[model samples]
Target chain A: MLPMSDLGRALCIITGASRGFGRTIAKEFSRVVRPGSAFVLVARSGGDLRSLQAELTETEAGRAGLQIRCVEADLGLAEGLERVTKAAQEVATDLTEHVLLVNNAGSLGDISRFTKSFTDMTEVNSYLSVNVSSFLCLTAQILQAFPQRPGLRRTVINISSLCAVKPFSSWVLYCSGKAARDMVFRVLAAEEPDLRVLNYAPGPLDTDMQLEARSKSGDVQLRKSFSEMFSQGQLLSCEESCVKLMKLLMEDSFTSGAHVDFYDI
Target chain B: MLPMSDLGRALCIITGASRGFGRTIAKEFSRVVRPGSAFVLVARSGGDLRSLQAELTETEAGRAGLQIRCVEADLGLAEGLERVTKAAQEVATDLTEHVLLVNNAGSLGDISRFTKSFTDMTEVNSYLSVNVSSFLCLTAQILQAFPQRPGLRRTVINISSLCAVKPFSSWVLYCSGKAARDMVFRVLAAEEPDLRVLNYAPGPLDTDMQLEARSKSGDVQLRKSFSEMFSQGQLLSCEESCVKLMKLLMEDSFTSGAHVDFYDI
Candidate 1:
């Protein structure tokens, strides 16, 4: 089991760190890791990453000597993946006792249509290129960047969803992407018994994604439910979900590669 | 439930139908369907497709009045998918009472390496293009081509594996692809209640895939197990596994979108 205190000296890399849950995690996770910890924040938006970098540097962990690197690149593209992996490698220092990578980058594909409407090969391929293929390859690249060594604990967190286990109508791309990612990391856990992998499904959070779901989902009933959840204040805040995730991480008792939901913890 | 004796007057399309389990399915299914039934066999190997077409043409169903069209194309490429869907659209005649689409085309991606070794985006994208993306898009296209209508039962059979539910060491691409495809079809079952979707895991079969697994799989234990299965003749022949699948279809008692294994039946 992990020690009774906050995580010490972790080399944390969070994708999609510019906005939403990724940004919230960056701020909240900073408060947990000790001084001398490093963060590699990656996203496509340069301005947002810069602002996040500034906000993180002013925090307690940052003032105590946290090193923050903002990587403005698309996690979906090969070149963008190269930049992030290279940044993480460069930031992996001798003080890095634990490695925690948050694979949070994803897109809710055109939910305005049903499964049968996704006939164009280019459209489908582009979706998988971003969500499935890139996610798998990026995790592989990051793990490669930080090889296993004595006293160096490695943990991979996938910001997964309920869709990973449940099938949602008109959510073919997002659900399949989540499902594939969960299985990919499960394979990672099976192969590397020493590594810790968690597929954390942050509950339906009140975020831009939820708004998109409410407005654009193809199934009218599903769309209305999202709107109702918002109106009823049933949606979780990013911090609310992240707190549960933090508790799970501190407990460190989850079966490696388990699909743990916010409510499950 | 589907009729007990035989499936009559259907437009049957099978991918990867040139050899292995797919070929067995084509031949076995030919025996069960009535006259005026059409068969669309798709494979990258034109010669193999031609030979299978010829073989299928000599069968009793063929002799009676079965129409066979060979699509020499790769399921991985857009052009190949276009060709198959076009051919299926052309073959959906007035006599076509039922449409059965067998999504059997897939590749066992580079299994000689671990998850951490698959860092190249191109390699990963190419693998997904064939296994994951193409499978989803093709299904959507076929469904679009043959819209749901009165008296026209639509059946989609995904040649899934235990890997769909169980992750294997170093079999990242194949396992995840299967998982994603199963979930994709599950969504299809949810969205289209009238459509029949079955994910059939054919156990371990004595086919070219097994040979490849025994020779090329990275994990020593996994490779040895495959070898042991082969040496002990524990692997089911293609015909044997297909017989179980045939039984499942003929009975048609399975819940739509269920992952029914050969042993389960």
Candidate 2:
């Protein structure tokens, strides 16, 4: 993914900025957007977001149009959303025009049940609240916060998963959470046809989350299979995935109605 | 559909029994399921449930082994879930072994966008609460409730729509709600391999809901298209779809994992 920003002077608020793909997207934003551009980094860990803020702020390319601010919030609760909202409001100058909402924070629930196990319940609730409810609220608030700015475009990129379309065994909560999240975007798009909403299915990526998933799976055979898959280089790099996402963000031909695959676009 | 005692002596719970598919399913259960068997009917309206209960209990087949119990409660909130849980506890009898949970209640949110309208918020929040959260809680509770009495076979039939797989243009809330519900069942199947879960896409059905949807779509061209589709026999009768569903329930070879299409099975 080349570093170029056509989204000039736009304020981008990315959740899950502490690590994984969100971090990569934020970095890309820093590289592409011009100097004096503002970014609001949201995550559960304040220290991690602050570190990334400092890192992005220190780069020569980052200094071009980048101003970083970090906000710590669970992003899964109402209070968390309020905090993010408050921070976005406080840094009002960066958010004058279009708002880019990237709902990237999510969890893969305990993958071991047809029955409702305790682990499954907690994981399912947390995932739904974080991945679906949080996205819905944040998107609604942003739309309300910044009504359509003339000559400026607003877009929502919901970082969905390939598991949404594929029936991967043991990824029940994760899969459903994603599917639900996709539906939210679909519904929102249908309601506001003009809104640029993308349910971005980025496929698989070689990330720490996958490693953590493989380890916590508990099933030895399943862990071995995942390890084999990961080792076979079937996963996308964070940069590769982010590049595709950036391309989609730049493309004007695609509308806000479909579940788009990164490779297809 | 022909009214057979396929369920025999098993216990079943059907929500949204005040009217529509919920009422039909409860009646069908009463017609089948041998004498002395339990069928707990849940709905929001008590008067309607009492009348339905009287009709079911009066049947000769009902006299054999069918014990119809009506529990009035809205399956749309935490209080509703608590009500249903209490009802489930009450319905548990010495003969109650296995349980078949049918999560069939559905709603169509405000058909019009009506931006900033209270209707939209009510429709969105209510639909989310009922069509997703309540159903999920129901699945969770039933799964947890059935673990007792070992060797008890449990089945969760999530009645989905064709729109779940194929995106619809205007029925934003209805289509997305069903889509999310279907994904919940998929997640359940993935999480619990032992449970028999089916996301039964009942295709387009000639139900009141469909008629209401066709009328309130606010597009003349779309209504005509929908009518043409139905007239062309694209829609199936409830009896036919229900029979297909019952067949899936009775069949032993249809292994469960994720979403199972009625057409495919």
Candidate 3:
């Protein structure tokens, strides 16, 4: 692992940076990363990402030459992936000392039992494209763009979930997509020992995904379980989860290729 | 479990039935299934399935009123899925006593180390589409097409692999796709108890896939390992694997939702 000082010159590329854990993590990184650090924020909503850029730029670290670039593109499409890849590469050229990737964008798609065929082909395709294929493409692009730069700290943190390991009642697509994402990172970690790859499961955080799960109509049991979890204050706040994640990211004790949970930390 | 006599009137739908284990399984079914039974064969190559149909029709089972329908369409595309679904439904209309769906189609999708940027978006999409989404869609359609008819045994056998549980260096897409397939069947088994879902891992078979793996260019270690396995005569022949699979399919002792291996039986 590179020294913490090298992080000052790190080029961090984060997907789904407009909201939820993505936004929270961006804020945490902005506060913690030193001057000369650059961030390339990617998401579907240009307005949301622009607003985030404004917020980050107003911070003290931003004033200290922390660069912020927003690339508004849907990760579900090939064109969007190309755009993000170009943006990431351009930003990396400016800050080549260290590179970090956060594949955080994901979709729950239609969360329903197999009996309920609510999810169409397009939705399923988008889910796999965004969650698995796109992530793999971007990671590959980044790895290729920076080919063994001496003293450069290369790290990838895939935001996975409990669904990766456990099979849910009505979350077949989501569970599988996340599981694939984790496996991709696991394989990458094995193939590239110099690169740090972590499949980080943030646990059940209070986010839009929770709201979506609670509101699903097809699976009554699933909705009830989510509602109960909400009522019992079982869901961790995004702020708390981001703090723990940031801590984990900064620590050198965490082994590469490890699938870690926030609760475990 | 349904009685063996029910197999006489069973409507078995097999995907990737043109070659390899699928073709062997189709042959096995042709020999065992009594007259009045129907087989719906789906694959990209129409000619191959037609030849198989002709061969089966020459046998005693075919002469005894066994109906064979070949659906020449790719399981990776929506149009192909629609065509196959329609064909299966049409075949089911005539032989609706017992419906068995065999999701045997899959793609390795440019198997290479994660460090090697060999797999493109198209290949990745095809892998997920063919292995996971298509399988899910077909399963869902079959379940809907033949809803819980009393005395109508509904069984879904998903052809999975050991890669589903173990992560390999160059088999990221294949591993994840098979894992997703297994999880889909697992979920279906839970949601639809009336349906028997089996995630069957045939082990390493002496099929085209093994040959392809042995000849892979990106990973020497992976290729060498597969070659060693082949030289050691560890890979099971397609005929041998199909025999074991047929026995398991006919057995009443095997429970629904069981992920079975050929050696275990």
Candidate 4:
């Protein structure tokens, strides 16, 4: 296999593509990949997706023959997974030498409560259904829909976080979910050595999630820390973090199953 | 504070106590704690729990006034959790200067397929509902049921595995579940300094789980390695592993929320 410099005519499928780091991924990835590469943007907001799609279609790559499909669906349900994978399969064979599945959709869970306060089974299960279960299931479904074949490179990027490796007070659910997803992809990388799996931690970006963290975290000290980060201008923009992620993909030198952080790079 | 030698007049609650590692924990803990310590054994099999309770009444600890309560409950269901926590509260007041909660119930998800083959959302959700979601919810419920007081010392033991830190092929569900549970406890420890949290990895023990792993693991090499461990008499007995866990608690020297393995000690 030759060293690849770009995501060659690929079918790139991204969850949470309507906002935040995922939106940045859609914009950055579109510019670097080949002309025939297709994009499947998935999210819960259909209006946001259509607007993003419209914006992408207006780009130079859009006029140069790039295909973009907006999938409006909630990633927390089975029906949502089916809709996205079906769309991915539809555009999979069109000038596609590479397949990219970005498992980026996730939830903040209920950070308004401490770990000890999270005793409700239904609530906990509901959180895992989206953050943990759906993420793993969607990845597997997309991989099955687009199987390994000659001249095709399959890459999976699990949008991981520092929370996955370190424990944060009052953020137990989020930490647990991220850790589980990262391990799932790690096992996938181990099982399929040919696959490119990278657990990318996109720093503490100035996204809506940061807004939630700074305003409403259950732990006082943690909430203060996040607020201080925002006030001190220490948070990275979505585009800034996405650039580092794209660099990792372009170089393709990262060890499979490894967690790569934007700050680390 | 004095150095503790035993679980002094404590209320000990253990899940999956009908057999295997959980059963060993019940036996070893009953023998070592103070005379007034109460034991609440929880499992799916009411019959097994009754027999174990009857056998316990024959022991010196039982005869010397150690209270024993059997709760027939599945840790996977919400109702099951409610039953166990209620029973725990009942026995909690008597002989309960210290509180010990052992989270020992878990399931080995289907190892008949590789990670890529796990595409069904419902199947994955069911597995997680039992192993990951229920485990965290149960711990949180127990802690909430028995709020920390000045006179009571609280300790939680999460029965983790080597799989929690290391990924194994065809064992994505088990790995992800264990990894998630460990991070949950780690966060709990960070949030509550008064709580004693131990993520104890009881090596590759000789149990029913090993039997299933040796026979059904989808990865041929991993299955053969487990079989080889069994044939060479290298697997630790449940009693042996339980003894190490007891020592960890008695010595009380491990870092809070740290993952300690049988081999490491």
Candidate 5:
């Protein structure tokens, strides 16, 4: 089990760290993580990552010698996945006290109403590639790179969604991808008992993803639900969601192979 | 709901129809389907499909004027998907009474022990492409091409597996792909009430897939289970399983969007 003290020295790798929950989670880690710990942030936007790095450096945690490395790469592409894997390996040289891999990146991939036909094959391919394939590749690489040692804690947190278990009208790609993600982690959990794996559904968050869903002109009911959720203040802020997630991550009582929801936490 | 009599003139599209369950299912379909009904057989082995076509042509069903068209295409590739989609469209032009799409093609991928790392990205991609993406693409195309008409039945039969709901150690790709396939049909069912979608799980059939699983050197427990099942005559033959499936397909009582198992029937 990973104790709060061990988190300071842990090698944490987070994908989609440029913004949204990824960014919030990264920031949360910075606040709690020890100075010896290194953060490897992966995202497509290099500029945003750089800005984040600069921002973190100016913060109290950065002043205390918190290490941060940014890898500008899209998880949707093979080259991007390769880059993330390479960066993680390079960053985790001898500092493998506890390794935490956060698979937070996802793609909705041309959301359309269920009444309409699906998008082109390329768009569908991108959805699976980015959400499912990339997660598998990265998780596989991490598992291979970090063998379970006696005292070393390894935790894989897959940022899944309620859509994974529940079907939504215009969210087929997201739903299926997240479901696949959950199963992947479940399989890994069963195979590697000593390793900690969590499929965490963050629930409705005030993220760009929600904004994108609101922007869609498809399905009136779906749109109305999103709008209603937002207006009712039901969507949790990224910080709020991250706080609960971080709390759960730190707790040894949280069982591995569990599909944990934000509400449950 | 389609009566057994309507099966004769329905346009049937079967993927991976060259051999194994696909081939047997195609043959089973020939026996039941009426005269003037067209069969689009999709597989990588053109030679095998041609032989099946010739063999079927000699049968009473073929002599009765049941049309058979062999589309020798791999569902793992885009071109193959296009070819299959095009064939389905062409065949369904005049015969729009009923259209049946059987997504039977699947790949177990490069199977290995749970302890070992996964196969390369290429092999993994093939599994998702063939098992999930192609299924989605073809279903989408068929749904778009053949709109539901009053008194006409449009049925999509995804030959899923128990592995879809149950996770297997070495069968990660197959399990996840099948799960995704099931969810795809579920979403479709909810959206298109006029269309019938059946995620049929044919339990442990005596097909080449079983032979392949039995041939694996990894995971002693998995191997033992397969060997025991085979030796004990626990695995259903392709013919037996197909019969049950055919009955379910023809039955109006069979609920759409249900994850049906052979035993359940």
Candidate 6:
């Protein structure tokens, strides 16, 4: 794991951490953060988040009172984004400092059929709403609430996917949605140089979504062909990627919010 | 001008056509469309559009009774999208085959300031409403009402900007919004191969918005820089770009709505 030296005093808000990468990110931050730093956990599953929060409190990096605030709300809709933004702002106001916003929450819809017919309009619409629209809303809200403050060194890390750069037949919606998010950060970083914005593509890993996609019922032939991609047993654990990400986050020399791949490390 | 062959046998609906490229596009299509085709123009300026409809009828493209229907409504809001969609459906019903959806209406807010402190939140928010969110909503509604017929080809052409691929320092919000629209087309094309969903980045054109931006008062350095960019004659004319675009649309070889740039052709 990258040593968390500079993060001791940083304030972070991570979304979609109920399980998978979000959970790993929060726990890792808790372990590395300085004694006075704050970490906020956001997701839809309150119960799972509470358990994860408790687990975070036990880590050595968690000693900073590691103020953990769990706000359970769906990040898929406009209302959900507003609720989280309000809650996050309250935390920001209490600390009197801008935050390191981690736009990590997302959805991985069924990948079995690849392209569903118009009859699947509901699914396609939902995918666009949650995976793409919500990110834009959340970004706008955060930027509007937190204006630039001197010496704050605020940052926004938009978690994207390798699938965004390469076209995946089955993940048409998900891949393109992430690509949209990637562009959001890219444009924002160029507009505001002071604010560090990173569009990250965490390569394929052992996440719940991947596991589910691998086993989805569909054309046995198609599934068999796709499954071979993950069968190489090279999937990175969330912890490994989180550690690498933290390393990048702590480094003062890196460009702000470039679309980076974990495998590149 | 690319001849609008067989367009008279069908219907085409375009949003945001009161002025700018939208007005030019509607007129261009009206010229080449089959005398029997219908062209529905949607924008906020009803008075201007009504006048335009009459002028269009004087052309040969209109001699064959090419219907011109104008719907004046704000398309940035959800209600507006629904209203426009309903109007579009009414026009589509009159057609024998299907409808071609052109999401050409867009805006680029003033970019005279580099610092967010001097930025106008209302303007940025408005840009998102029109350029980003509403594109998806309109596309969804169109897909819902889209006529499904065997061996029939339907297309959704999204007019994007060169700002989508490359970032301009002061145009973050506009760039992000345009990029998001392109991403939607990317996903839509992949999911529905039958529907010709395309995202084309029409290069910088001499539009009223650009002129307004050039005349804005703000950070002297930034504003002067932008003014120079315009003064140097770096922008393309709307008619020139439209002619190029018409070539692509009529070529009929661009099967999927992949992101195409004018220079590429």
Error of 2 at B7 (Å): 2.8
Can you list the residue pairs that collide in candidate 6? A8-A34, A31-A61, A35-A64, A197-A257, A198-A257, B8-B34, B8-B37, B197-B257, B198-B257
lDDT of 4 by residue, B120-222 (tens): 8888888888888888888888899988888888999999999999999999999999999999999999988898999999999998889999999999999
- TM-score (chain B) for candidate 1 is 0.98
Query: Across residues A1-265, which tens digit of lDDT does each residue of candidate 3 receive?
Result: 5335224577889999999999988888887776778899999999999999999888988888788889999887778887877887776654467788899998887785453372256667767887888988888887787777677778898999987877677787888788788877777777788888898999888999899999883568878988999999998998898877777777755777778999899
**All DockQ scores:** 0.85, 0.31, 0.52, 0.90, 0.49, 0.21
- Candidate 3, residues B105-169: lDDT per residue as tens digits? 88786775554483367768777887888888888877777788776888899998887777778
Model 1: residues >4 Å from true position, as ranges? Answer: none
| Per-residue C-alpha lDDT of model 5 across residues B1-265, encoded as one tens digit per residue | 3366436478899988998999998899888777778889998899999999999999988898777889988776678877877887777656557789998988886656562276256556656777788888888887887777765678899999987787777777877888888887877777777888899998899988898888882656788899999999999999999988988877756778789999998
- Show model 3 residue runs off by greater than 4 Å: A1-8, A93-95, A112-120, B2-8, B93-95, B112-119, B252-255
Alpha carbon lDDT at A120, candidate 1: 78
Clashes of each: 0, 14, 0, 0, 3, 9
Per-prediction TM-score, chain B alone = 0.98, 0.87, 0.93, 0.97, 0.94, 0.87
Which lDDT value does model 1 have at A199?
96
Model 3 chain B, TM?
A: 0.93
Candidate 5 falls in which docking quality class? acceptable
Give the per-residue lDDT of model 2 (tens digit) for B134-211: 787788887776674565667787878776766555565566667777776765665566677777777667788778
Query: Candidate 5 at A88: error in angstroms?
Result: 2.2
Q: Give model 4's DockQ, 2 decimals.
A: 0.90
Query: What is the lDDT, from 0 to 100, of the residue A103 in candidate 4?
Result: 88
Span of ten consecutive residues with least summed lDDT in model 3 chain A: A112-121
User: What are the interface RMSDs of all the models?
Assistant: 0.8, 4.4, 2.2, 0.6, 2.1, 5.5
* lDDT, candidates in the order shown: 0.90, 0.70, 0.80, 0.90, 0.81, 0.70
Better of 2 and 3 by DockQ: 3
**Which window of ten consecutive residues has the lowest lDDT sum in model 5 chain B?**
B114-123
How far out, in Å, is residue A248 in model 5?
A: 2.0
Real interface contacts reproduced by model 2, as a fraction: 0.24
Best candidate according to DockQ: 4
Put the candidates in DockQ order, highest first: 4, 1, 3, 5, 2, 6
Over A38-59, each residue of candidate 5 has an lDDT whose tens digit, in order, gives 7899988999999999988987
| Model 6 per-residue lDDT tens digits across residues A1-265 | 2333666466787889898998888887776556667777889999998998888878776544667788888776566777777776766543444367888888766666543332233455566567655666676677777777764657788888876665555555566567667776776676777787888777776888777767872436545654786787767789889888888877745577577889876
